[model samples]
Target chain A: MRIVVDLNRCQGYAQCVPLAPEVLKLNGEEALTYNPNPDDAQRLRVLRAAAACPVQAIIVDQLDLKK
Target chain B: MSSPTNGNALKDKGRIVIVGASLTGLRAAEALRKEGFSGHLTIIGDEPHEPYDRPPLSKQVLKGWVPADHTKLPRMLEVHAEWRLGVAATGLDRAKKVVRLADGDEVPFDRVLLATGVRARQWPNPAQAALEGVYTLRTSNDAARLQAALAAGPRRVLIIGAGFIGSEVASVCRELGLQVTVAERASAPLAGALGEVIGAIAAEMQRDAGVDLRIGVSITALEGDASGHVRRARLSDGSTLEVDVVLASLGSIRNIEWLEGAGLAAGFWGVGCDAGCRAFDIHGIVTDHIFVAGDIARSPHVLFEYQFLSMEHWDNAVLGAEVAAHNMVCEEIERRAHLLVPAFWSAQFGVNIKSVGVPSFGDEIVFTQGSRKERRFVAAYGRRGRIVGAVTCNNGKWLEYYGAQIARSGPFPPHPAGFDLPGDMRVVPAEFPARGVPTAAPDVVLTGHDPSERHAEFRPRAR
Candidate 1:
């Protein structure tokens, strides 16, 4: 799976940080920081994080290819 | 990714109707498909537009970072269902299995989900409420209008109540360099939610942010010019402010009037439902088909002494919708319970406020981590020798840990600190003022919106 986070649109709601800590996280300044390429094992959680965002700032695509 | 979830996967089955086509409604529609409920799914909403994100209305939308119209909640999962927008469900015929719409259309369903959320509580005085320059934020249109009004640069803005919405609006006013005053009948801002201890700090934060913080006071009356534009407001202290804008942030009123003759267990506290999200009748008997979710759902929480809690947080809406949808199509044994932990977050004045569990249910608070003096800390709220809730300010990392402890119903002021604590980590009494306390001024009714605020007064009569 591929992960894309819109840093410009991220207002640091930090909802994604908890749901997908392995893929998305917050920096020391509390700004959003995340790994664009997460392991395949983190697919479900990463997608869940994308759905959880109220701002819809996170995008997870390319699910059919698996790994 | 998953292309689109096909509700047809489960084959044609019983009809499932979801009311309130907003966040909860849309999510519930998707969940019905995810849970293999292929029945005829119909969604009815009062709003003309699709479901939009409301959390940004006060923060980013007001700050102009995002246009109110652009805050639409993305439909990540395709919901193949009949969409009936711009119409409200006027009544529910539980016995007949029909939902009456405002347009006189009765949508029949094998099961129905009530997600009719709350509306902004208007000013008591109709004349004062109708005056120009007075506003309330509950919908996207409201945010847009308020945004335009703010952009016009009013000389002074008076926020009548210092609740979350009011305080956030004040923050935006200051961000826009507008002179702002915040009035609260409580001793401090957020005192009703966080109790006087944390509320005092919030009051200081507002004052420090250049807000004219007026505690223990209320607007007696709003005086307007001949053009019917509100220009001034009379205060409880016998003072009048030359304010151009007045925000009636008195909180929200649950939208349940339409269900008046419907005979469902609904009132000011919203619709009563079992843990599985099945609606309860007036006699407290759980219905088999009718379901309830979102900010409108009042369900029992085992964490809080089996008391029915109605939470208005964004997370609650999503979680409740999924659970309700799952239980709607499943049998008794396969049903899922909407046992939400009641978490919420808010950002204002450069501070992030996040909480887990029900803080208002606790009797005392302890600063388990960090220091309040430094304006960053974590406090645990305890009740009956158990940690019922925990709140964090700029300390989000530890919230999940605290949430686990709260879920375990750990001892009040859990020992060992678990991590580093301030030198004086003393457990102090959480001073929750009596509900509906008599204010110093008769004109100002300080509504303590604890989510379950009016439930105590509502349940007895509902029974």
Candidate 2:
């Protein structure tokens, strides 16, 4: 699984931080930091955090079977 | 008649129509598509633009950090639906299962989601409100106009109310190096939402930021120039300020007027709904086909003594929309609750305030961490011995912890951990305004509490 957050679109609402702590975290300055790819176990939460984003800055792209 | 969507011709997935194509409506459409519900979908919106994020309209957009039009919410999901933009839903025809649009067109639906949301409350005097410099912040266009006015360097800006939006606008004005005066009728800023105790701390923040904060006073009238632009404002305290810009942050009015004769339990408190987001009829019976979401929804919370909860916060709108969407296509047993642990965040006066749950639901509050003197602390609000709400200033990481406590229904005045507790951790009355105040409380109110509603099962709490 791959997760991507658009730095330009991110408004720092921090709604994503608490939902998937292991996959995403807000630094001391409240700027978003995250693991772009993670194990499948955290897949549901990552997608949820992406959807919960008010700005929809988080984009979780599924891997291509061909790739 | 509109042509049927291609997928609908092959299979019967049913037709779903959504009104109010903003955040909630857009999110709900995404959820429906994600849930594998391929159906005929139609989204009706009164605004010309597509869905957009509103939180930044007061913060970054106003501060010139982001363009007002650039804040449109990204459409992450592939929703193949017909779009009806820039047209209002004038009425609902439930028996015929159709929506009446302003253009005299009726869109049939197997089910519909009412996410009409709310609009900013207009200033009482319509004539004065029509003045060129007078404004209210609720839409992208409103922010754009307000931002342009600020860019012109107004000598002074008069903010009429001290609600969340009002306070944030003042913060932006300060950031722009502009002089701003805040006139709040309550005892303190944010007195209605956060109560007087926390409002005091907010008041100090506004004052320290060089704002002319006026409490316990009301605007008598606004005086405009002959050019039809606002020039000055008169106050009840016998004071007049020559201000170029006037912002009325008085509050919001739910956009449920069209649902009047449609037989849904809708009124000033918004539309009443069940836990699963199913709308209740005018006679108090849950309707399977009609659902409600976003700020216009006032569904009961099981944890908060079954009190109906309505919030204009971003979190609730997204979560509620998803829940309503899920319930629309699923069986009764598969439905879920929109029981989001209501959370919100606001950055103003260099202080980041975050909170979870309904703080206004509590009768008493106590600061569990940090100190008020330092303007950084965590306060817990409790009622009937259970922690109902909490607020944190510059300490949002702890929001999840208190949210759990609120969900657990922990004891109030939480027992001091045997050590490191502040010496003067005293409890105080929340001091919310009396029940009758128009804008003091959130849009949440018991449908039964209203005298006219005969079928509601709620009694107004003694204030």
Candidate 3:
């Protein structure tokens, strides 16, 4: 699974920071600073982080095995 | 037209995504489940905590009667669903049927509900906003922090807005035996919502409560200590007040950034939706799968001549959530309309102020029942010779009757029995302040911008 965040729309609400701190973090200015693509093992954390966004800004893409 | 037999098409439970995990989101979730929605349910929120009550934050919580975190809203029923706490939705991909989050993850949903509420508007100047002692009250954490600061016993408290929150803060300050000062950009307190005459009464109430109320004054600059703690505020009227704490209760901004390219009928005013809670796109086309509710939801009112109304009251959140929930899972024919009349209340300065309907929609006001001097009166607001709103000071019992009349589009100066009728029955101009300007209270605004643009403007820009 791969995660792709649109930095332009994130307001750094930090709702995802707590849910998946390893993947999503906030900078000193409190803007959302996150990893674009995490390993497959951290897929659940990525999903949870996406679910926690109030503005629904996060997006997770399932990797296709054939590709 | 046999009722558009699409019930069977929706029988297969679909994924429902609700943005915002506050009062409206929680209640709507419970409503969806209660209405037999077995589809996958996902609730997304920017706050880490579960949905909680916000009304008590300014009153009981701040007064130390209840802890801010403990002011959780009572769950009417259990809503078993995926709890997405702490992440913010950044974009909406309507064609893909997905909601994008900041972490670059997308949640696929057949239907979506935009319950993302509003946030407290901050002071414009970055230097003043960065001052440590200056604060804006909106979230639970904000209330908790401010409550602790107030308990620390600052020398004096200065409030820069006289809206309900600011007024209530002053009332709380009095209860705490602390000296308080209120400065408003408007001509009088509550002039934006209730107009000049009623605003004058409110201004008097604040003065009577010993608040150094200053109207028609704007904060030019906020001076801070060496450590960046606010020390004094310079007013536009060429006066400065030495204060230890400063609170800016300017108003609130809707939380709508996530719907940037989702291309819904969303703007600065809020996401436009029908009375049935279904969201409309920019072109005004209603989509069945998308819905909206709560403080962020803007819909038209039948009683107010089909003018879109946006409300931030607690009652509207509860009522709007229920209606949105019912319409989300049910068929179009079985769906319900969210025509709930707006109502709100505030306990300040030994007065229990309650109001039904949107007073700003009214053009005139009359002292229908009780006297303003006694601080126990019911003022009726009229628009085009019909009662549209009513407010009662320390007299809430008569609100229901007036509310019903407003809901039913009753006559101006509603004549409910048991009140002395004045032979001269005249209505006076409310003299409300112009829209989109600074005032004492939060005006229901339509920001006419995408959620993303709204948030971007608030972001600290590089020099």
**Candidate 3 residue spans exceeding 4 A from truth:** A1-67, B1-12, B420-425, B437-463
The Cα error of candidate 1 at residue B405, in Å, is 0.4
lDDT of 3: 0.79
* Complex DockQ, candidate 2: 0.08
Clashing pairs in 2: none
Model 3 Cα lDDT, one tens digit per residue, B1-45: 222124433434578899999988988888887777777889999
How many angstroms is residue B192 displaced in model 2 relative to the true structure, after the best TM-score fit?
1.0
TM-score for each prediction? Answer: 0.84, 0.84, 0.81
DockQ of each candidate, alpha-carbon based: 0.09, 0.08, 0.01
Better of 2 and 3 by DockQ: 2
**Best model per DockQ:** 1
Q: Give one digit per residue, the lDDT tens place, for model 2 in B190-307.
A: 8888889999999999999999999999999999999999999999999999999999998999998788678788877899999899999876889988999999999889889898
- Candidate 1 lDDT over B197-237, as tens digits, reads 88888888899889999999988999999999999999999
List runs of model 1 lying over 4 Å from the truth.
A1-67, B1-11, B416-418, B437-463
Docking class for candidate 2? incorrect
- Superposition error at B3 for model 2 (Å): 19
